[model samples]
Target: MTYTVNCSILLTELPLLERPAAAKTAGFDAVEFWWPFETSVPTDVEVARFENAIADAGVQLTGLNFNAGDMPGGDRGLLSWPAHSTEFQDNIDVVAGIGERLGCKAFNALYGNRIDGESAERQDALGAENLAKAAAGVARIGGTVLLESVSGAPNYPLLKARDALDVIARVRTESGAENIRFLADFYHLAVNGEDIAAVIEKHAQDFGHIQIADSPGRGAPGTGQLPLGEWIARSRALGYEGYIGLEYKEPAETAFSWAIRA
Candidate 1:
């Protein structure tokens, strides 16, 4: 099985720019990341430095997240938020530029948490619109836009494979953008009470990318009760031939021990 390190969550012991090289040295040829910049439109120099870090490290950036506003501050994403619509739209080119430069084709777009005053119906509509725009932005490279179901954020709406797929279907029907797809992150799904085996059996082919950590503590595979190796095997058996992102939270030094054991 091919694995890609998620530098944003794992490898936190090192500076952001250094994680790609660290991951490369740790025996991974591919990596993925959440938005690394503080702003949606970072200076060109900043973008170059980020691009160069991955290039210098000789690791392929297999997947990336479009700027989901203030992740550390609890902003899940900008897609459905009315106030941040411009910010989200402004980010599309920058994201596409990075993807173009690094040969990364999969872009994950987090659906924003539901606002207190905003109607759920309106938010869903806005999210679909922004997702279509994102789909169009990366269409030049034949790239895919990913929608994910997240856990732990109480206000965030997407909590199941069906939820994400519903948005994807809306994007396809409303905008005629065929490039949007589901990002199947097993840890979040399991935490949200999804049946991993059933999801794999039914929608494995619909997944544009896959991310994993064990459930409960969201630690390395062995730290939780999830049968990660078996789940991965089932996904592959169902024809999921893509990078499985190692997006767990654990000390970097010991993170890959589970892989060694497997």
Candidate 2:
């Protein structure tokens, strides 16, 4: 029943070193972030600084996500598109190597969104093929990638847990990459009106890391509709051994910055 904080909250305010420091202040022993390689790009010295922060704060690096563009006008789905390009494989290998060196075993491989004029089945096949390639690349470096689901109901079509699982199954069947798994996010699950606890229990075998934030506002634990603590307890009860990632927005005030309940 341990927890980790996402570095996205303090990214703009704190530098890399200070981000872990803040997490420790907030009573977390580990932290995760969304693609820190560029924004908080870690040089050798900077990586050393981050290592010191982890040691000083007694925090571990939970997971790190590679950038997948889902911004407006960008077609960001990784598996939903072709992934065999030499460029894509090279990028995955490079980042995955970095992740392994940093002692981070888990990374998020987000399939951004479905591109226009692509049939549903076509996108699914493309996404699976690309993801399997990326998974193979990541597995070579002793790291695992989590296929995250995004639900863009009012926008482009999103990938659900079932879709992510399907991709995982396909990769296992076709390429047999053992490292790739699922990053079950509560916020996105709630957005799609899925059963949070049930999903965790049913898909525990495929899950590598888990993330949480209350529904509706996507704010801190108790501020919104989702029963975060209950869900956490269920995961724990189901024998989840990975870190629970807190990927949520903080209140405007600094005082509420790291406040977490349950």
**Candidate maximizing lDDT:** 1
Give one digit per residue, the lDDT tens place, for model 1 in 13-103: 9999999999989888999999999999999999999999999999999998999998988999999999999999999999999999999
lDDT of 2 by residue, 1-262 (tens): 5778887664447666677777777666788876654422345775565556766777788787765543344544344554423334445765666667667778787765555666767866666666777777677667788887765444335446886787788878887777788888889888887877778788765678888887787777767878777877777777677888877777434424435322
Q: Which ranges of candidate 1 are over 4 A from the true structure?
A: none
Predicted candidate 2, C-alpha RMSD:
3.6
The TM-score that candidate 2 achieves is 0.81
Candidate 1, clashing residue pairs? none
In order of appearance, the predictions have TM-scores of: 0.98, 0.81
Clashes of each: 0, 6
The global C-alpha lDDT for each of the candidates, from Candidate 1 onward, is 0.94, 0.68
lDDT score, candidate 1, position 49: 97
What is the lDDT, from 0 to 100, of the residue 224 in candidate 2? 85
Per-residue error (Å), model 2, residue 88: 3.1
